[model samples]
Target: MANIPYREVLGSLMWLQVATRPDLSFAVNMLSRFANNPGRAHWEAMKHTLAYVKSTTHYGITYCHDSNIKPLGYVDADYAGDTDRRRSTEGHIFFVAGGPVSWASKRQDTVALSTVESEYMAFSRAVQQGIWITSFMDEIGLPQDTPVLIYADNNGAIANTQNYKNHRRTKHIDIRYHFVKERTANGDIVFEYIPSSDNLADILTKPLARDAVIRCCVGIGLRDVEAGGVL
Candidate 1:
């Protein structure tokens, strides 16, 4: 396995992950990081992702035509999920017309000092995506007028964006992450705290039980084609 050239297969998986398989995004992202140094364990992980895809080939995002057309976002962070570097993974999913239209799962550029900081950065990145999407919608003649709501599971991070107080834990954070705060204040984007159990972005931040993944798949509008509904 150490001598195997795995880039081509990995690239195909990456394409599928971006195109339709939101569930495989985290696995693809994690495995891609090790593509150059793939060993037995890495190859096994790739095989696992392939197996998961084989089992859920019919899963896809369906845009419900008659529903909430405004874009809604769910953002979450796995606090220091990367064991080796202690970096957090940020995940976000944007829903429009009752289905997910865009999503992301990627490692943070720098290490976060705390869970609040990680969540803050995650929300900030979501805001950036939201802003871009809103602009694109405007160009397409479906301009959105309401604020984009970004749901977060952490209360401390939500409070940090709203209050802006330089508290001990958040005082040292970089100024760029506060972009979410500015948009939030202007009513362009709203940060709302939701129960972690209900945050669908959980799927993108880390691996979970099969049941949990199914629940998240439903949350983000990925449905099984066989039953004409969620699996």
Candidate 2:
């Protein structure tokens, strides 16, 4: 493992994730953390990601020509998923015309006491990006409708956005995370609940089974180009 070029391999994976591979975002993000002191297990995981990429070389995002499809966002979080720091991982993806336009997978800055806090934190970050996407669309003559819709699988987090009253469980949360509540109130964005089974952003928050991976890939417009319209 000492001889392995972990950082270089990670950089290549990072470029792939940023360029056209939303499915690899979480895996690459996780592996990048051990760059400075990677073990044999980390090296094996890096190899796995490379092999997966090789097998899916023909897969790419496919934009369907449907004008009715408008911009929408999905956000999710895995609470205390970082074993080293007890930090949560937040992930989100925004789509327009049936294809992802932007997406991210990042670790939370603070330790969340509950799953709801982790989710709400993720919501705040997604809203910031969501608002930017809406503004950019408007400037490009593709003005999106007001109150951009963002979907989350956590019912508690959705309720937190609507309920301004801070209780014992939530009062300790950072002031910045509360921005999601204000945005909901001022019509900048709206939070809606979706079943976890259907939340495409789930792939970006944690490691998943192969079946789930394919489902999310298809959901977000990634296609098996060599097979002509399959994921």
Candidate 3:
């Protein structure tokens, strides 16, 4: 007999992803789609994921005491990543005191015709989350200064955020997403271009090699208690 009900298994995995296993967010999100019609391959994949979790059960986020480090976020999009829908996946992670506290990885709600558009959509979503988180922090007495740094790997998306003039290319985008531009111009947020290789949010949108994944996890202060390693 199977170990757990499919729904229960999926729910538990989702909770883990949200709690302390951002590394598993993409994998769990992908696997969850197969819950309704899980074949043997899907079951095997789930079991493998569980095994990985068991092996790294002691790994968790490590918050530092430093408060001088600025709050920063990285956003990325995998253009046309989904094999079935050809929709991009938007991923973002926010860090404070050198550790990630908020992250998301999900398919874009709308189909973007260009990489710039996909990146713009993803950046906008990150900006919204950034604003909300900043406000929450402020309410809790961790108020940050104006203009949080938001990193995006796409130059076009960064340019779009810094400028308001609409060209034929960007005119097709929804008006709501223009909030990124408004926030940037109003000095509430700043968009910076980061090289794709250095964008930590990349881990959320796509699978990476083992080394890269571990590097990112370490960079964000995720420690493995069992291994006595602070990563």
lDDT of each: 0.87, 0.91, 0.83
Write the residue-wise lDDT of candidate 3 on 121-182 in tens digits: 89888988888888988988978898899888999888878676776766767574578888
Tens-place lDDT digits, model 1, residues 48-118: 88889889988877888798788999999999999999999999999899888899999999899999889
What order do you get sorting by lDDT, best first?
2, 1, 3
Candidate numbers, best TM-score first, in rank order: 2, 1, 3
Q: Which ranges in model 2 have alpha carbons more than 4 Å from their true place?
A: none
Instruction: Judge candidate 2 against the unseen true structure and give its global Cα lDDT, from 0 to 1.
Output: 0.91
Q: lDDT tens string, model 2, 1-231? A: 667899998999999999999999999989988988999999999999999999999999988896445679999999999999999999999998888999999999889999998998899899999999988988889886778899999999899888878778877774755788888899999989999999999999999999999999999889988889796
Estimate TM-scores for all models.
0.95, 0.96, 0.92
By TM-score, the best candidate is: 2
For model 1, the run of ten residues with the poorest summed lDDT: 169-178
When summed lDDT is taken over every stretch of 10 residues in candidate 3, the lowest stretch is 1-10
Give me the displacement of residue 104 in model 3, in angstroms.
Answer: 0.5
Q: For candidate 3, give the lDDT of residue 85.
A: 88
Off by over 4 Å in 3: 1-4, 67-69, 227-229
lDDT score, candidate 3? 0.83
The TM-score obtained by model 2 is 0.96
